[model samples]
Target chain A: MYKVKVYVTLKESVIDPAGAAATKEFKNSDYPEVEQVRVGKYIELTIGDTSKNVEEAVHDMCKNLLVNTEVEDYRFEIEEAAAK
Target chain B: MYKVKVYVTLKESVIDPAGAAATKEFKNSDYPEVEQVRVGKYIELTIGDTSKNVEEAVHDMCKNLLVNTEVEDYRFEIEEAAAK
Candidate 1:
């Protein structure tokens, strides 16, 4: 099996309210040592052994649904899954 | 600077509605190649150089806010940030 890890994050030009709130919350919670905080979506996909072009399939997945291209950017890492 | 990458995922026993929906959507979207999908949160934290124990501080942050121990599990990878 193949394991694909996808990270969907807001574009640098976009404002992230959730991230800003978390930063403020950390500062107020006595974690004044923090410099920055960013929050995003992490998705893991388990792909069954197949002959299909996995890379193209995943790229389409991200572009079509997993990510909002208008405001978010996404990247993925692929690896073989260890034997169960 | 220290860069911390945190992944917060639902416990195995917990049912993930968002994941289920995504799985169904994939199946219908001509991507029968998909097997399974799990969704979670990805967080990045930047910490300034300090005398405090970095690992301990991050652990506290995860336990106090980044994770919901009742339903989610979290793990972190820390590394030195690249010079900007």
Candidate 2:
């Protein structure tokens, strides 16, 4: 089995209103030093097979559905799991 | 200034109901091979100062407000940005 990790985040130039709101809330709660906040999403998947075909399929899923490539940028890494 | 990256995730033993729902939805959209999805949160903060006091304040904010230490696990890294 292999573990896949994906990180999805807004394009660097895009404004993140939600992130700003969270930052505002945090600052108001006595932590006034927080300068800025940018929020993103993380996803993990465990694939049962380690075949090349499976890896290609997973990549296709990430490209077409798992991430909105137009508005978001995503990066993924696949790693071998320790023997269980 | 320094950049702080924080990753917050549900404990390994906890059930991720939202992640499961997202996986189900993705599978229903013709991507049947997607086995599972575990969702987490990522936060990035840009602190205006790199002083030890500033770093300590950022750590405290992360511990008390940025992440729910009870149900979530978080890790952070600080990096110096390329001079612009």
Candidate 3:
């Protein structure tokens, strides 16, 4: 089994209103030191068993549905998942 | 400056409907090998100069606003950010 960690964020060229809002909120609060904030989706998947290469499988997943490639950028990492 | 990477995940006991829906979609699609999918929020923050410890500052941010302690769990990593 493999544990896949995916991070999906809006492309730099795109403006992130949600991220901007969060940053403003943080700055207004006690954390004025926070200069910038970006928000995105984090996905974790547990692959039971597979003959295909883990990297390839994850890449396919990301490209297909995990990310909106046109406006979002995604990256993933695979780790040996512990047995249940 | 510091770059903080945060991962917010729903507690294991919490049911993730979105994740379930995505998993079903993947199974119906070309990637049946995807057994289970879980989804959550990913946040990246850039912290400017501060006299306080980075860890403490980040922990405060997480506790105060980042992670919803009621149903979510969060963890963060800090790295020296490159100068812009």
- Best candidate (score: DockQ): 3
Candidate 1 clashing pairs?
none
Off by over 4 Å in 2: A26-33, A53-55, B26-33, B53-55, B82-84
Error of model 2, residue B73, in angstroms: 0.7
* Candidate 3 per-residue C-alpha lDDT over B9-49 given as tens digits, one digit per residue, 9 for 90 to 100: 99999999999999999889877878889999999999998
Summing lDDT over every window of 10 consecutive residues in candidate 2 chain A, give the lowest-scoring window.
Answer: A46-55
lDDT of each: 0.88, 0.77, 0.91
Which ten residues in a row are the worst by lDDT in model 3 chain B?
B26-35
lDDT of 1 by residue, A27-52 (tens): 88868778778899999888877787
In order of DockQ, best first, we have 3, 1, 2
- lDDT tens digits, residues A1-84, model 3? 888999999998999998999999998999999999999999998887778888987888899888999999999889987768
- From the highest lDDT down, the ranking of the candidates is 3, 1, 2
Write the residue-wise lDDT of candidate 2 on B1-84 in tens digits.
667888888988888998889788866865554567899987887766544575677678778777777778888888866534
Candidate 2: the clashing residue pairs are: none
- Which structure among the candidates has the greatest TM-score? 3
Worst 10 residues of 1 chain A by lDDT: A27-36
Tell me how far the alpha carbon of residue A34 in candidate 2 is from the true structure, in angstroms, after superposition.
3.1
Measured with DockQ on alpha carbons, how good is candidate 2? Answer: 0.64
All candidates: TM-score: 0.93, 0.83, 0.95
